[model samples]
Target: MSRRDFIYTLSATGAALSLGACSADGGSAIRFGYIADYNGASLLAIADKQGLWKKHDLTVEPKVFVNGPVQIQALGTGNLDYGYIGPGALWQPASGKATIVAINTLAYADRVIARPGINSMRDLKGKKVGVPEGTSGEMVLNLALQQAGMTMKDISKVAMDAPTIVSAFASGQIDGAGIWYPLIDTIKEKVPKMKEVASTEDMHDHIFPTVFVSAAKGKAERDRKVMKVLQEANDWRAAHPKESIALTAKLLKADEAKVAADAAHVKTMTTAELVAKTKDGTVDKWLDGMSDVFVRTGQLKKSPDPSTFYAGDLYTKAAAR
Candidate 1:
């Protein structure tokens, strides 16, 4: 498709979304950025519907962005204040363009699928394994190999994009494919016999948490009151999974069935849970885990410390209220 990673990984695909407004101010008005995707903006939609914004007397000018980079860019330029972001775009924060404020959803859709006989990650050893070289598929494949006590050197890595990898798999050119949903779904429809051998869920010690990000370079000052209200929304999302799905679809302006399918791959948690995780150091560990993946994959020269981008203290301050 466009310049992107695999779909259902939440960084994939586009939707017909053109909603929101803007008003400049502090106490009453806030310029919020969000993508037209469930994993990114679902909680905000749910919270808004529950009157959390009004409870806090907020007039949020909710802006829809295409992807993380675009949202980060807007934040950097002071065009927006806070928004949702995916794991792949954490580099934006690491570079001082935005700051990680809170956790959004934990997504576990990255997969490595293989022919029916390939029952485990080890089964793909010495086989032609195709993946989009720089996508989450590649990361999941690397993690899968490590879990299987193997590495890329042990397999034939056929480096290609999502579509090409799917083509190769469908044509039997590769014994397995490292990819995510929608694309993985496409491969399944074309090659129904293929089954999942490994997924992000298998990497038990690691996480793929989408986050709520705010200004790093932008001029807007942080507001503890606003953060408190957003946490209220998060609380609602954790308690109402099914209703949240319906509102998230409307926020994304996407097909409800597609949204439902994608929603299954995510874990929604309350603000108290997120605060507890941060206090217990799990949030820092998760950020560092993703950082390590980026470094190992050549996306970063070295891993940046979580304190450089993560604002766990800030999250705590808000949640305490």
Candidate 2:
């Protein structure tokens, strides 16, 4: 895509999150890929503010994409050294375009926002629902629908980027949404009549897992070092939620209040917490959940064994040090 097409796509997602600027480094530094939303790359943004990259002596450049699929496509072109993607884009790794160097943050933070008079998930049948394709938003929507004894077939599904979803919901163009912050917060601020019909918080069996992806060929040890920095940042964010939100708002050029609203949906884990989760098979299970959604959504014909692309053993070894 050209610069104009790229900018337009990013804006349409409604995150308006930018990683500042990039350089013509010519392979001098790692071209780090991240989604252009706080939800997409919040961990890395926090690490950047915390000076973890410099502390680790790792050179990484932030390249912003509208969503995980775009990020994965860039990864395939030999541009991005590594990237973080939500469950919606997990198919990329399952197909061998990239490898999961580290199981990224795991969470259950999405909610269904509906126009008033729609009191519960059951009411969504035949109603227009907007969600970004392959997003945790969609994952949450699917689970929420299942809870109501329904599926995507029950609702009029409209695939949109987060920004477009926000616009449509705010202007009464759509009936509901399965989107995350800061877009969710935007709807709350602008559309007073909107009611939250469902939250992933109530779904114990569902998890929105994202992972750090490297090109199909990546340095195992080096990726672990990068994972170390991310885990440290994750731990730090867990300990300082308010500061993390403030820093994210400043970084995204977004409102502090809106970013703060996102805390309810974000769950940051410490290294010990991650170490524990990794050992218990929780990470593997979530990876399965991620890949399963793509197949159910008809994005992938077959999802490779989640373990086939997972490099979590390397993460456990890194944490041991």
Ten-residue region with minimum lDDT total, candidate 1: 11-20
Candidate 2 per-residue lDDT over residues 218-287, each given as its tens digit:
8876787788888888778778878877776665556567566655566667778877888898887787
> Considering only N, C-alpha and C atoms within 3 Å, which residue pairs clash in candidate 2?
13-163, 14-163, 88-134
TM-score, predicted candidate 2 vs. hidden true structure: 0.83
Pairs in clash, predicted candidate 1: none
Q: Distance from true position, residue 50, model 2, in Å?
A: 3.7
Clashes of 2: 3
